[model samples]
Target: MTAEVDAYLSALPDDQRAALSDLRARLQILLPDHHEVMSYAMPGFRQPGPKGKMVVGYAAFARHLGLYPHSGTVIPLIDCAPFKTSKSGVLFTPDRPLPDALLSQIIATRQAELAAGYGKR
Candidate 1:
């Protein structure tokens, strides 16, 4: 993980820190070729190379935590039923962390989008 991301997670509450750290570990394993980055002030992974797009991002909030797929359409394509979802992200909590299978689906969908050259600026 990047130092910036480490600092960010270190500053969060114990529960939030633990949850995100777990999520971060899962992401790292899933995206071994991606680069860890602090984008939009949140911790996330980006595709390799200098101009690679952001694959996914995550953040902590007062009442909940969020996993951002960085695309307006990604969340809709996946099953995020129990957790609250928006156009760009899924709202979850430390008490009820996102399921491992669901997180895998999210990463897969985002990677597919990147491969297709979607969500490009």
Candidate 2:
């Protein structure tokens, strides 16, 4: 996490703070090699995909903690669609628990999107 991201997360209230933390951990496990950075003033991770690199970002809004896959990889898939996340990324409301299964599917689809972009691999 970048200093900016760190400070930003540190400032969140306890509830949002915990939810964002969980998101950060899961994203890290999903893309361990992703380079962490701050993008558009938000914490972001860039991971290599099949086609190119994929970027995931995070933010704790007043009502939700956003996990941005950035890429459109998971959009068309059904399992991940429940979380939808609009045209942006997944959203977890404060006090609402994070869904591990949904996060896993999102990560997997994002990776596959990158991989498929490269080739049949």
Best by TM-score: 1
lDDT for position 102 in model 1: 95
- How big is the positional error of residue 113 in model 2, measured in Å on the Cα after superposition? 0.8
List candidate 1 segments past 4 Å from native: none
> Per model, how many backbone clashes are there?
0, 6
What lDDT score is found at residue 48 in candidate 2?
51
* TM-scores of the models, in the order given: 0.96, 0.78
Worst 10 residues of 1 by lDDT: 112-121
Give the C-alpha miss distance for residue 12 in model 1, angstroms.
0.4
> Model 2 — which ten-residue stretch has the worst lDDT?
75-84
Q: RMSDs, each prediction?
A: 1.0, 3.7
TM match of model 2 to true structure: 0.78
User: Over the stretch 76-107, how does candidate 2's per-residue lDDT look in tens digits?
Assistant: 56354444366557776766655777777767
Candidate 2, residue 45: how far the Cα is off, in Å? 1.2
Encode model 1's per-residue lDDT on 10-113: one tens digit a residue. 99999999999999999999999999999999999999998989989999999999999889999999889989999999999999999989999999998888
